[model samples]
Target: MVLDTQIKAQLQQYLTMLEGDLVLKISAGEDKTSRDMVELVTELEKMSPRITVEHVQLERTPSFSVNKVGEDSGVVFAGLPLGHEFTSLVLALLQVSGRAPKVDEAVIKRIQAIQEPLHFETFVSLTCHNCPDVVQALNIMAVLNPNITHTMVEGGTFQDEVKAKDIMAVPTVFLNNENFAGGRMEIEDILQKLGSKSDGTEFANVEPFDVLVVGGGPAGASAAIYTARKGIRTGIVAERFGGQVNDTLSIENIIGTKVTEGPKFVASLEGHVADYDIEVMKSQRVAHISRKELVEVELENGAVLKSKAVILSTGARYRQLGVPGEEAFKNKGVAYCPHCDGPIFKGKNVAVVGGGNSGVEAAIDLAGIVNHVTLLQRGNELKADRVLQERLRSLPNVTVLTNALTQEITGTDKVNGLTYVDRVSGQEHHIELEGVFVQIGLLPNTEFLRGTIDVNAHGEIIVDKHGATSMPGVFAAGDCTDTVYKQIVISMGSGATAALGAFDYLIRHTAPTQELVGV
Candidate 1:
């Protein structure tokens, strides 16, 4: 059964409180996933008396159906509910049980205002941690509004449909059969795109700011707080507030605390930044930037903003494996975030790509939970610290493969094996495993600024110790810059330094604002 004792206990607690008879009618076929689905629901039935799962044998192969006891709910899952979409399945069950997902009243109202019926078929894999946020948001919207229907289509189970749609990524949303969004979108982004208020503004109508922080992560938040405290008209425009921090699962390195999760930490960050009078603009990505009198920042949504000084904190994202089956089995067995997805592969064999510190650390972490780990390194030796390698060597279940190049991720519905080539032997080998953790490296999000500002060879923005960029009025911070460390505390420190640097530049270069001369 996929549901472990811990998850079963958790489901028991939730389903025990279930108000109504939550009947899950599951139809499975001849495929292996179909059998897996049957096993999963059979285990769920044993969790709580309120949860009654019925197994309907399907004549066809690989196709399945799951729905509540009602006819008009218009909510269902056509595949197995595992991985990150597991969140969607659980939340949807809770919603059907008369419990609502946590959402703001303002957002609920905005969702209710949608005039036309919108069906959001969000294609997702079970391992995608970011997919849950969008799926949960849309599910809550469906619960709030009768005009909306949201379905989580597990990409692995439904390959024919995924191929038909030409979907290359998880979290790709099809709004009413049209391509709506591409990647991780905030709740605000979903609302605005569907039918909420306009997210764009004319450059002339927009108010000027003394400083504008382009990102809303720890760095951007810290920068905006520091700049606004100086009594200057400071603003921030971010694609999302938390940025890469939200993707992080466990955070123990922040000096003050022993441990904290990503979501709660980001919520605290938003609350902390709310105390100041900062013009926070969430759910906006910068399209381009140019210096015309002031730094002109144009958004993908067609809005243009002007600021005297700017701090770049766009942050970095995890690099992909670019191998076959890597995209298709992303959440199934091929994963990127070990912290976020390591637990999903408990008691299962897995492999890790790269020999860096992150890869070795991930192997060490996963070894405690999973049955075994096979680490593949392209280099002759481990790039991680000697201590880390020693610790990894201490683990009996962990195996290290040096000078290996990952060739393909092999699996049908769920990832069960990986093929890699030995660089020295010039021979290919296959390892049977459930998961692949890719920890090669990170690429900064600074390609938009080709040469507007100086950047390192790795595309990271070049900034001084004070967080000042090569340009006079511009500064940079966080993972997007050439900072040695890419942690939260370091990014926050750099952000504050950038704000202070921008403030100093403004004081020396720009004229002071005229005070009111009225009686």
Candidate 2:
């Protein structure tokens, strides 16, 4: 059997939910991957009475398509969908067998409304935690709309195709044989990219909020919940619902929970928020914020929102290398998330930049997958924990260089090498590599409030102990503020403090509004 006994048992339980008969139309060759694919499919067929296998020709060999008994579903997998993609494969089988996908009805309508034929292929690694979201979203679209077709192209099994397409990132999507997008994206994000209207009409005439949280990460979610508990009008606007937490892999620092992943934690947060009456506007960005009769917040979609108080919890994003070719080579040969993109560089030389915990951890992880890892640190010594540093040093394929400053990421179509300077010797050196993973740090997402708010040189909002900013009635919290420590629990605590601070400001400063006075 291609699957372990434990995995096969769990898969058997999920397969029992199949609503109708389905067939696995497989195209195979006399290769190892093909043999593995055949074994996996036949094993699955034996587990479910409703499933059967059919040998057939497909666009890609060592691939298979899950279809209803009579019609094609247009959802294909180009390799073994185990690891992080195993859930995606199971969902595909269930949905293709006439089971409804658990998505919003409005989103289903939008997917079905697309008239243009779109053939999407997403390249992914089995270890990528972020790739399944994009793959599942596109698969849902394929299952919902006959005009849309999607294929999960496993990069490890089809390295030649990945090289031909010059793909260095997981979940890199191509539409109609051309690059469409890269990185993790939800179904709504994909719809927006396809010109689906996300106009602000739905929010234009909405009632003003008592408190408006400007982000939807851990901080924003906490604040919104706190404010809504007070029976006041609460709203949250975010570029994406989960913010930086969505890209996180494993998080072990959360209190009460021994360990949890980022996406899983965000799901529970969303569920908790759903229990309240907060108005959530996701996939939207705040373009400007100003104080008038009320704090007027303008969204990039041309919608204006007014609130008695505003809490800034926009969170932070990955800091770029800022060196030459870094921006141009993004998704080409430069990447940020080692967990998401590491397997794509299997058996190739790569470099990890930075000396902190994230950098050292990335170097240690990549050393197991990539052929070699070169870790560059600008400081005289690594800033990681002694245990982590010892572990990273133990890796035979890892090379550590202290006092090294990156100069450029040299590449033509893809990353060919990187140039760095040895600060102690004032000497420059270049190394040929296939990829560069940057783990420097993060920059606060406070550009939109730069001129209006009191921000430090690093663009972090200045906040007091109560999370109150320089501007009265404006509160800031979480990593976007000048918080000494940036942790999920700390962000949640600050969020509560900010919400209570906003309520206090509303009671003292603003005249007694009906919502506040409970009149």
Q: Which candidate has the highest lDDT of all? A: 2
What's model 1's TM-score? 0.71
TM-score per prediction, in order, is: 0.71, 0.92
* Candidate 1 local lDDT, residue 356: 88
Clashes by residue pair, model 2: none
Tens-digit lDDT string for candidate 2 (1-519): 679999999999999999999999999999999999999999999999899999999999989999999999999999989888999999999999989997866678889999999999999998788899999999999999999999999998899998888888988999999999999998889999999966777776788888999999999999999888877889898887778898888899898899988878888998999999988877788899999999999988788999999999999999998999999999988999999999888899999999999999999999999999999999999999999999999989999999999999999989999999999999999999989999999999999997899999899999998899988789988989999988889999999999989988878887534455332
- What is the Cα-based lDDT of residue 266 in candidate 1? 86
- The true-versus-predicted C-alpha distance at residue 152 of model 2, in Å, is 0.5
Can you write out model 1's per-residue Cα lDDT over 61-168, one digit (the tens) per residue?
333333455643445566777765676777777787777666655566677788888888887766666777887777777777778877777776777787677554
Candidate 2 accuracy as lDDT: 0.91
lDDT of 1: 0.79
Best by TM-score: 2
